[model samples]
Target: MSLFGDDELPPVTARESQLDFWNQVAFERVQAQFKSGSMHHALLLLGPGGIGRETFAQELAQWVLCQNHSQLDSACGSCKSCQLFVAETHPDYHLLAVEDEKTQISVNQVRVLIESMQESAHQSGWKLANISDVAALNQNSYNALLKTLEEPQPQTLLILQAEQLQQVPATIRSRSQLVALSVNEQATIEAWLAERKGGMTEELKLALSLFPQAPYKAEDFANNGDAVKCGDFILDISCLMQGNESPLALAEKWLPDIEDCCLWMLLMMRDLLLLQQANDKSCISLQGQTEALTNIVNILNNQRLMQLNEKIVELRSLLIKKSPVNLSSSWQALLIYCSQLAQKTAKSA
Candidate 1:
C-alpha cells in the first residue's frame, strides 16, 4: 500500500527505470546551480504524481549529500552518504509528507523539521530535505513553513514536490526557485505501464484527461478492472443525458462503486468539453463514444461545460478528503445541468 493506503505505486526499485530521464534532467540542473553558486534554499518541483518527481527528489538528495562528490554533478552512489541515503537512514536528510493519520502536513511536523535543520548535518555537509506534496500544507502549516524557507540554513537543499502548484501561496512560490516537471507524454506513460506489465483501460485514458496531475492514480483505477466497467457505464450515462429518459432508473442498478461512478461523471464532463473544442477525433481519446460525444456537443457551450467539469473536480477532491460524498445527488445535478444546456442550445438554434 502507498502512503495513503492506496495499493498504487510499484515498489521503489520497480520505478527506477521509468525515472532515469527525469532524474538526469533534475540532477543536471542542480549541478549547474551548484557550480554557479546560485542554488536556492528551496526548490519547488511541479509535476504529475507517479511520473517520478518524488523519486527524482530522493536521488537528488543523495547527490547533494554524497561524501565522495568529486564533481559538482553526480553522486558516486558508492559514497558513505549515498549509502546511507539508499538505506533510508541519512541523518542530515528528511522527508516531510502526510503519512498515515495525517490528512495534511501540520505545523508540528514543520517545527520538528525546523529544529532538526537548525543543527549541523551529521556529516557536516549539506542538509537535504524532500517535502513531498507541499500542497498538502494547510494555511497554518504554510505560515509555519514561511520562517524556515525565508531564513534557510546554510548548505541546506529543500526539494518540494507538489501536484498542484496553485495551492501553494504566492509568497512561498516566489521564495523558491521552480523546476516544473510536466505530465509524462503519452508515449512515456505507455512505455512505463508496458514495463510494469500493467494493463490500461479507456477509464485510464479518461482519468488521464480528468486528472492529468495524477496519472498513476488513474493507472491504479484502471488495473482494478472494475473501473473499466464504470467507463462503459459513463458512456451510457452520456447517452442518457441526450433525452428525457431518467438516469435515476439505472443509477441504482449500475452504480456498483460510488467512487467509480463519480469518476465517470468527471470523465464524461471532460469528454463533453473535448467534443465541444476539438474537431479531430483522432487527436483525443474519446473511447469510440462518437454518438454520445455528438449529443454532448450539441448541448453544452464551452463555459457551462467547463463549469460542469469543475463541479466533478470539486466532488473528487471532497471524496479524497474522506468527506461524506453524495454521488446520487451529484449525478442528479449533472443530469439537470446537461438537460438545461441541451434545451438552451436547442432554443438558441
Candidate 2:
C-alpha cells in the first residue's frame, strides 16, 4: 500500500516525510488500476486540505513510468525510467501547478503540457502529466484543458489534484477516474506519527482535533514548536474575550500561528455548539479543550456564536479572493468583534 512503490517494489527508505495509512491505501488502489489495465487516461484525486494527495499523485506517476512495467501494481524504483522520474528529467513526465502565488496555471501551461503529450515518450512507453491544484485554474484554463481530456494521447496518464472538487467544472469530473482521499483515522494517524518519531505533544493533539485527518500538519507543528506559541496566543485570546485586554494589542504579540489561531477559534466554536446541545456537562467533547473554549463561549450566546462563526467563514472566503485583506488587521477586527459580543453575553447571562 506504500504510495511510492509497489508491494514487490522495494520500499522507499530515503523518504524524510512520512505518508499516512490512507495515502498508502491510495497507492495500493493506483497500483491495482495499473495492473488490471483499467487505468484511466485522466484521474481526479479529490480530498480535504492537507491530505497527501499531491504526494500520492507524484508517486503514482513514477509507478506508471517504471521501465519494467510488468506486474502493473508498482514501479520498479531502480529502473532507468524511474531514475529519470526521481531526477525529474523524465521526458514523458510533466507537472503543472500555479506559476506563483499571484498567478494561476495559465492556459499556456496547459497548452504546453498537452502538446508535449502528443510526442513519443523518452522510454517509449507511458506519458504522465500531473496538474496539481486543478481548482486553481481559471475558467479559460479549465476549458483549454478540457479539449485535451476529450482527445487524450495514447498511453498517456493525466492526474488532476483538486482540493476544492466542487469548484471544478462538471465536464472535467465526468472524464476523470475519480479517487477520493480521506484523512486517516485518529488512531491510524497517531501511530503513523509515532513511527515517524514525532513528540506527540498537546499542541499536536489540538491541531489533530482541528485538522483531524492530516497528521503531517500536526507533525509540522511538532517540528516547529508552534504549539507553545499557540498556547500563549490562546491565553491572550481568552483575556481579550473577557475584556481584560485590548484585542488589537493582543494580535500584535500573537503571531507565530495566525492560521492555527483562526482554526482554533473555529474548532472552539464547534465545541461550544456541542456544549449547547449536550444535556449533561460531561457529554461535552471538549474535555481537554475546556480551558480554551470556556472564555470563547462565555462571550457569546448561540446566535452571536453563529454570527462569529460566519465571520470566520467569510474571512476564509476573503482569503480565497484575488485580493486579500491585511491579515493582521482582519484578525484584530475579528477579536474586537468577538470581545464586544462577549461583553453582551456576560450581561445577558
Candidate 3:
C-alpha cells in the first residue's frame, strides 16, 4: 500500500531511470541557476499529481549535494554524499511528508523541521529539505514555514512539491520560485511507455488516456492489470447505459474498487459530454472503444451527462471526507440516475 493506504503506485525516486522526459527543461533551468550561484533558497515544484514533481525534487536534491556533479547535471553515484542519499541516511537531507494516521502535516512537524534547518549542515555543503506534499500543510504549518522561507539558512535549499499553486499559501508561494511540470506529448509518453513496459497494447493506451500526464502511473496500472479492469468497466457501463446490463449487478461487481469505478464513470461521462459537443471520437479517453462510447454517448444528452458528472463528483468528495455514507447506496443511486436519464433520452428520441 502507498502512503495513503491506497494500492496506488509509489512515487518515482531519484534512483528511477533518468528524470522523466518532461522534466528535462525544468532540470536545465535549475542547473543553470546552480551553475550561476543564484539558485533560490526555496523552490516550489508545481504540477499535476503523479507527474514526477516529487521525483524531480529528489533528483535536484541529489545533484545539489553531489560533490562531483557532471556538466549534464547527473549525480556521481560513487561519491560519499550520493551513497548516503541512495541509502536515505544523509544527515543534511530531510524529507517532510504526511505520515500514517495523519490527515495533514502538523505545525509541530514544520516547527521541528525549522529547528533542524537552523542547525549547521553535518556535511560541507547545502542542507536540503524536501516537502513532498505542500498541500498537506495546514495554515499554522504554512505560517511556521513562511518565517523560515523569508529568512532561509545559508547554503540551505528547500524544495516543495505540490499539485497546484492554489493549494499553497500566497506568502509561501511568493517566497519560492515556481517550476511547473506538464504532461509530455502523446507520442513522447507512448514511446517512453513502450520502451519501459515492452510493446504497447490497448490496455496501455487506455491507461495513458486516463493518466496522460503521469506515464509512470499509466505504466503501473497496465503492469498491475488495473488497466484491463478499467477497460472492462467502460464496456460494462456502456452496456448498462444501453439497457443491456443490470446496474445492481454492475455496482456489486465494482464495490471492491468503488472509488476507481466512480472515477471511470466520471471519465466516461466526461467523454460523452465531449462527444456531444465536438461530435468527434478523438476527444474521448477510452481509445479503442469508440463504438461503445458512441453508443453510450448517443443515448444521453449533455444535461444528463452533466448530472451524472455532478453526482460522481459529490460521491468522491464524500469518500474523501470519510463521511458515514453507505457505499452500496451511493452506487445504487448513481446507477439509477444514469438508467433514468437513459430511459428519458430514449423516450424523447
Clashes of each: 0, 1, 0
Which 10 consecutive residues of model 2 have the lowest summed lDDT? 10-19
Question: Predicted candidate 3: what Cα RMSD to the true structure?
Answer: 8.7
What's model 1's overall lDDT? 0.69
**Reference-based TM-score, model 1:** 0.73
Off by over 4 Å in 2: 1-20, 48-50, 100-103, 198-200, 247-258, 275-292, 317-333, 346-349
Give candidate 3 regions above 4 Å deviation. 1-17, 69-72, 239-259, 274-284, 287-292, 310-340, 343-349
What lDDT tens digits, residue by residue, belong to model 3 across residues 8-91? 532223333367778888888998998898988998988766788877888888888876654436676656688899899998
Model 2's TM-score against the true structure: 0.80
- The model with the greater lDDT, 1 or 3, is 3
For 29-91, candidate 2 gives per-residue lDDT tens digits of 877877888888999988766787777887778767776656435565677677888898989
The most accurate candidate by lDDT is 3
Better of 1 and 3 by TM-score: 3
lDDT, residue 68, model 3:
61
Residues 1-349 of candidate 1 have per-residue lDDT tens digits of: 5677445522222112234563566667766887677989899887766556877787677767776454535566665567687788989999999979767888888888888888898973889778997778777878888888999888988888876666567988999998877654666766665456455556666556655545566566557774557556756666665664565655565555666667666666666666667765655455656676776666667876777677768766765544456866765665566566666776776
Error of 3 at 154 (Å): 2.1
Q: What's the TM-score of each model vs. the native? A: 0.73, 0.80, 0.78
Highest TM-score against the true fold, candidate = 2
